[model samples]
Target: MGNEQSKEKEKHVFSTHELVFNQLNEAPVYCFDQNVSSEGLAFSHSNLKVRFPSRQDQFQVAYLNAYLQLGHVDQTLSVRARLEDSVGSIAVIGFGESNTRSHSDLYLFDVTQRKVYLCGDEVPNVRLPVCGDGDIIQFQVDIGRGRLSYQIINSASSKQESATAGDRSLVTFKFDSADLPHSVRPLFGMRSTSVTEPSFHVLEVSRELSLTDKALFDKESIYGPVTLSNDCLNISRQDIKSNCCALIDKVLREGTHRWKIRILKDVGASTCLGIAKHPFYVPNMYGMSSQHMYLHSQLMVWRSYGGSLYSSGSKLSHELRPLDYDDKPVTVEFLLDLTAGTLEIIREGVSLGIAFKGIKPPVQPVVVFYAGCEKEVQLVSFHSNAPSGNNDDPILLKQSGSKRSSDRVTKKHKKRISYAFDRSMTYGSLLISPDGMTVERRQSHIGNAYCLINQTCSTGVYNWSFKINEDQGASICLGITTEPVEVTNDAIYESKSMYLYRSYMGKLYYNGRELRKEFEEFWMPGTIVELILDLVNGVLQILVNGINQGVCFGNLEAKAYRPIVCFYAAMPKSITLLKFEHFPSEPKAMFVPNNLNQGMPFQSNGLSEDIEKGIQRTDRCMVCSAIDGNVVILPCKHAVYCAAHAVVGEYCIVCERRIESIVNVF
Candidate 1:
């Protein structure tokens, strides 16, 4: 028995520290002028007048050298940590490096703000229980399972009240450990304002490097203003006036999915339950009127059209009666069939029938709350059947009783439209694969080359995605342009008529100007970029690695536009088309090839010689016969048009070329 006990002791380990100031190593101590007390286990700013250090307004950190072997087993650290505010500066206590520290490597708890942060970004929806000035806090690490959690008790408001309440209140926050650094040490940080300095204290510290059942919850699965249960199935919100949505991280693409939601806090008038495309970032509830489908608690069913881009195509059908919220816990059943494209709602064992139909795949379930609607809902049960693919059939979608059924669902049962690089339209240096799905530039190519998609888009939502097979230090550009726009060596980057997303700077550009600034460069080998062209809403959204980066452009015109890819590289590189999906729309191409005038004569005058020599173009409106011409037509590069005539003309009068776009020469 004694030998077995010795072996058990070797498997389990524990450590404790009194947090004495003198026993702690304070490296580069000049970062702050401080006073310390070993008996009290406290560190604070000194009252002595001295030269202010550069770290005055910033966080100064100190941690222990005794690193824990987190990978071996689960570990828990318990301590009494507290922050005393002096003019709103912050004090932090958590896990990180002691000697050299930054926000990126620190998993810290801000006592002043009452929030937990990992890599400088807040762990969304993790609640921290309210605590008094001083309370016991705990940090648990399960490195083998990639989970980290924080917990604190809700102490009473006063010392007298605390004795009676007995410390029952508790809240916990769980975070993904993938973003955490491998090594960690117990750490504390403090920041001081010029007027007053905040203080941080670790009254006691103890760790048990052994297994524990304290943390096994999936707490990080939801986002927004909501509280979740330990199982992460129940979500609740209260007292928030602004519109917010609790979006689940899971995407149900092609399957028959079913989930039961029990109303814990009766469904309010402002509550809506629905499914939306992933990365739904419409700021206001009104803006959410598009691109998503939902069932309002007020007996209404909303649907996203399979044809149009915006919510104007969204149909809302009124139910005969509203749900009876008087029932303490109303359980509502939601069934979605992607194979047949339908959604049915059932309440209290009664089927409400197919509430919605024609829903596309690749959507996520969401719950929207508005105007301080206090509500609590629990996902009691969830199930998804086999994958399905007939959701896009026009004949099946027309059964939704759509008023514009003929306009919305026109195409018959046909193969999904796929696009590839047009081999005949590519530059000399670029080589296209036999199937046209992949394109590669020759190793000898040292300059830029371009290629256009075989198909063009006009007035519907289209999704095009591609993968960078090999980058080879190349600068890639992906965007759309008019059909007539010339694809010169540098036209993709410099053309005023094209909208481009440049990979080199990770920014959007248009008309030779930067559209938006992005910090992270996203173009590299194996990176997949997806673009959504919503023509009806005039918006273009880009997604990288299955994450939507929001709208890149919001002013697209109703003209023929072809997807263009161009790159400049010193060595050969390859790109492959991965997926393509387009919604049906009326065909409208502004550029007509047969309308070009190859030999148009210019007016004989002193400027005629200069025009022929490419010195200057004409300054007369060929359309309305106006001399104050200031508009330049695209493709043929004719400048003989006034501003008013250019805006309304269908084609350039000089070259008789279809006018894709016009530039005002102000």
Candidate 2:
């Protein structure tokens, strides 16, 4: 029984004749050292061992480079492998025009300076600590266009502790196999001073990778071609002009079917790769938001620069910014599921977690490449994993943690926020536009309120700005506070208030005392007033027309705070609230105050700004007390708005006291 098992370990003969492994023994599956014998190479402990390690220069006795017998075609391939805990380098042992190892190509943990090389370039020295603990190394190869691309990843980190597709790995990145053969062989080599022969080594070869497209591009074509071939549909880099780069016809079924488009390229440079339900056409990443999905009457999800995924224009996963991708071979995949109304992203076989959910149905892959870009984005393949459009049918999906778009966005600003208006928190006479980008005070009364969906995380600058569209003096107090505000009340800066405010005079008032002053006079209309909470300096800086006003108020602690805007304007005018912005752009938009001061001012501004009986309230609505209170806001608890004026801007008209965060709520 032991002898027969040893024979089985000697080799694995497959029916497809595409792969052949020598199991854990000696000899090469494809190539063997001229001086090495079958008995010279042995598997001891859990590592490969040569008969003699001191004889490093003596042929087969000291070194052995064994190649797998399995042969792969010049297309896309996925070969899953597991590496035992060893500091010594083991080359997958194949190179263009040669199959050998050099000291420079030793895969290192600290990525090398010459990390990325094209065809005829040296092998990459990769070092991944994740692989130090016997992790799954998803070794993938793509052989096409007379070149080979290699990719490796740690299934552990990528899966987020989820059962890996197989095991674990150390490093991950995709690159072309330059100067390699069209029909290539696999290799497993062992070389190192710390190599141990303990445990066991295993290779789990899954299904072979094949192109789903009917045809591939003709490499011999000298001129650019866009026409289809008899067995293969053809589209070249030249055919991609403007944003109309590539479009596959595999549309998915609504509520059931999900579709994915795979492109072997980098995802950045203003290009957008996504799935749309209709015949979509967009100019750029920004245009993709309003352009295609509207015409198709469905949802759209795409991947942009540095691996930043997006649904429409809003970002999905900012965690993997501009993915740690170089100009190597990458399988940029965009997955859209109608069953869950979600979209996911996968790069080089590494799962990037679920991107977006609540995406409406009917989707197809739409790739747009801008002209004059050097990035080669080829629509190499596509497929659908969904069943027919069955609302009752359930599909088995294993996805990483992703955010839900359908969840009440009031709690989350990064997903979607400025939808016509702050569904809640606007008071009487407040008119927000249809897109909620503009807010207007229709009534001359003194009780308009506005607040933004500011999810405070901490650190960095928290800011938002608005252009004085109409006139000034809604009292227009811009401040940061912890207490929830009401539009019926005045600009409360003191008396039990742990917040600060600044009127047109640019004076930071905390508890009725001027804590910090920026300007001596009131600000002019049409000037952009940027309210900035500099958490690092522990102060709030107000900027007018890009001019920094030093520090407004300091002593903000590390806690949740809101950006508030209250106004009982002197005139019935308007102000356009722009998207929430911050200095030194960061993907993480939370503002967690860390400098809580025990002596932070809490005194109120004393006198309230509410309308008295003597001040004649005119032009305001009778129900909500607004001149043109339009659109009923949905989210805030103290919601009060009429069904007439346009709902626009970020600040809540009623619950509008403090700046919640400095993220792009609009």
Candidate 3:
């Protein structure tokens, strides 16, 4: 029985099919000798027996996933993922082998260099953050593309915990893999003389990686009290005394591009929209820094060069200034034509031609918020007109100049959604109307008032419209709370049971922590506020005055959630629930993929952005090409198979991995 249990444990050990470290009693050494454990491979003055894949499997696409353990980590430590021929490769087993023949097409993460190197060449455009102990490193060899890419993530960052594909925090580099031999092997070499030498623990042998869309804001570049929504395209902040800044993840090196920013509120001069070069200080949160230019609402152009602010910033012509409208929210467009060495500002499709001239390339669009400003902004549209093969191809403006259209789900279902304030859950100060549509806070109540909706949202998409009689300054905290919630003032941020959008600060709070994601629209008087709870995909979004505010929170718990509202002051004005709409189906499930062929590559026609936003699970099955995909592939967690196709293959067609199990959702 003991021997049988040991054999079961060995079955789960991650390794190539050609090598089983636990079965061998003697270690194989070609150079620096190191014994291999079933747990991982440690590189030091020790010998490890690791075998490369056989010649038949050499061209197959595989992913090498591992956790890099840093030892005595500092500027002197280094690690390399080298590609070498399987036959008679001396550098594969040698430590710090300087011979060029053994290190063909190698990628190195060196602490001393402060840069990632691809085959001894410095990787372009990718920034290398500081690496610490227990960081994750993944190497991908794409046989179809004939390319090799390496990605590394710092363990200390919150991004390491995310399973989302195409995470921008990962430092990645890709190069041609054509030079690799038929029996190529990915070997690891490290500087390990100390007691705590870095090691690589094998997690998986093979997997496919998803592509990235460089359209959203870079979460890593954000600083201060700013909150980003709409997949980081919308930026907002609370009324605060300090400034904050954020930028798009893509760098505008060289190309003709155009993007639009819609001001959701009248920010006046408190917010500045502009562009800045690389290596700018973000703590100051200044839009007009060295090599930067910004537009203020007061018809002033803030300009800086060579780390110096312009002496006469307001001297720019008034015609070049952005046009102001009486409407509450205004849309502003920026046309950056690097080919013409100019930047143009457009308002309402009117050209404020050539706001700045003789400008160079390699700058990022930035938004800065000053002290004591309550503002909300969204990147409504972006386009690129650059030709192919440009330095900014990924971010180039589309030549046709088309904008991203809203794909908001609006279809109605057979079941209608209806809910009202739960009188049983209402606080003492709050009064429910006879019709149960309006709730008023009595003037006699002093501390707080609370109310909950009658229905519990467990599945499907739901939208509830709300309206306030007046903008009673900073009086409401409203959002969703988990089940078994009590009527208490401290319940807002206390037990991680609720996610609230505080009208007092225009910010979001959850579990005693202030999230960087804020509500992009203000809660004004007499305007319709729609709270969209998509239980199908586990996301919460807001729409003000019929305009969507993108997703405020994602990956919400699958537990029963109740809508809640709280008033902090005694106000006679009543808050009313206008309407409720429910669609008892997933957004992706309604529309099936055109051609669901088995083993066919999934083509993303810009719908990948939606797929990444919790819509990766599809309803179309590959085998029968039906829309009844309910079975989810285990381990990969991909729900692309229908009931019939679920048991058809031993491997998942999407990720090309062995199916460990299958479970039907819903």
The C-alpha TM-scores of every prediction are: 0.31, 0.26, 0.30
Q: Write the per-residue lDDT of candidate 2 for residues 244-316, one digit (tens) a residue.
A: 3345544445534333333444434445556654323211111121122221222244434555555543454
lDDT of each: 0.52, 0.40, 0.49
Q: Give the clash count for model 1.
A: 0
Which ranges of candidate 2 are over 4 A from the true structure?
Answer: 1-421, 453-460, 486-501, 520-522, 581-666
List model 3 lDDT by residue over 1-666, tens digit each.
Answer: 999966874554343233211212121112222212122332322122233333231111211221111111111111222222222211111112122344344445443234556555666666544333344444444433544444542243443345344442444344454343322333453333233323333333332222133355655555445667724577887664344567765456677888888878534445666675532323211112211223221112322111112211234433345335344777888888888877777777887566666666666676666545577778876777766534332222111222111101123342344467888887657767544667877567666667888878887767676776654655777688876664455534443667777765567776656665455444455555668777765667664443334445655767788888877765554678866656676433222232222233333333333332332354355444324566666666566677776763476554445778776655
Models sorted by lDDT, best on top: 1, 3, 2
Q: How close is candidate 2 to the true structure, as a TM-score?
A: 0.26
- Residue clash pairs of candidate 1: none
Using lDDT as the measure, name the better of candidate 2 and candidate 3: 3
Off by over 4 Å in 3: 1-412, 487-495, 571-573, 587-666
Error of 1 at 339 (Å): 17
